[model samples]
Target: MKTAVVLLPGLNRDRDMIAALTKISGTPPVTIWQTETEIADDIDLVVVPGGFSYGDYLRCGAIAARMPVLRALKEKAERGTRVIGVCNGFQILVEAGLLPGALMRNASLKFVCREVKLEVANASTSFTSGYTQGQIIRCPVAHHDGNYVADETTLKSIEDKGQVVFRYAEGTNPNGSMNDIAGIVNEAGNVLGMMPHPENLIEAAHGGDDGRALFAAALEVAA
Candidate 1:
């Protein structure tokens, strides 16, 4: 599958993402810099990899959201392109307005880095179809602001629509997110945003391959 990863200034996980995707899909992913005004033609999926984009200034992803590449990202998403945003990438999606809610500082106000247990809330989305509903997946999360919060009404609507795709397991909430939500999908299911680093779990080098299924799912969808 032909996949593209947008690389912004300060992007640190582009190589990690490319390595993961190359292993899972047997194809090297292209890296598109944020300054590029156009995404490559025939790209099957687009990933906004994790990093302190724009040095996390003015909020984690605020500045990067307005970059030239994001304009193309929005257009591609609108055209039903598969998009996945991880960690700071998730922050960028929210700031870009492609996804809702904002990622805020951990409720306890500390940076967190650890393996987290997450339950698959809904396995029907293109990005998560590899897991069963309620299955536990171990993914690493590293960030100072991984807490996810939304107004009650929006949260309720997300639940009502089955858009809440992943949640920290009971009693294992690492960031104090509302309802322990770790990831969510859009109504169309073509776009996904999550705080966990699926790329980190993609190979035996990382001690596990639980997240390989996520990229597998993306490849299947793209095919």
Candidate 2:
């Protein structure tokens, strides 16, 4: 995929994201700085990697969400370009209004950094096509404000539309997210927001390749 990984001032995972995208696309992904007002026209996928953007000041993703690049991202997402936000990126998505709901302080009030099981709640989207519905995959989660919360009406609507892409598996609600939602897609399915770090689990050295399917599916769409 022709991808761009956003780099925010406080983001710490740009290298990891860049490495993963390079391995998947066979080329280094473009890096878009927070100050950039536009994303490359040729980019097919935009990834927002996990990190403490803006040092989690004010709110986890508040400052970063207002960065210039997100305006471009919102435009691209509205135009049907695919975007995926992992971890803090997910928080940014919510704060930027690209995705629904908000991420709150973990119910436990503790930082959670561990591998958690996730189930493919919906596999019809491009990002999840490599997995079957109800399939289980293990991905790592490392964030303090990863608790996903939304009004009951919105939650029901998303569920009814199959926008809940991934859910924490049995006995695996590590952050006490509502309905155990680990990830979700926008109404159009071109945007995804998830708290898990799939990039961390994509290589053989990472002990498993369960997360490879996600990038493979996205790359296929871009190709």
- The candidate scoring highest on TM-score is 2
What's the lDDT for candidate 1?
Answer: 0.89
In candidate 1, stretches whose alpha carbon ends up further than 4 angstroms from where it belongs are 221-223
Model 2 accuracy (lDDT, Cα): 0.91
- List clash counts for every candidate, in order: 0, 0
User: Given candidate 2, what's the lDDT at residue 76?
Assistant: 86
Model 2 lDDT at residue 160: 98
On residues 66-185, what C-alpha lDDT tens digit does candidate 1 reach at each position? 999999999989888999999999999999989878899998798888999889999888888899989998999988888998998889988999999989995778889998999998
Candidate 2 regions off by >4 Å? 221-223
Candidates in order have lDDT scores of: 0.89, 0.91
- lDDT (tens digit, per residue) of candidate 2 on 1-223: 5898999988887788888888878989988988899887789999998899888999999999998999999998999999999999999999999999999999999999898999999999999999999999999989999889999999999999999999999789888899999999999999999999888888889998788889879889332
TM-score of 1: 0.96
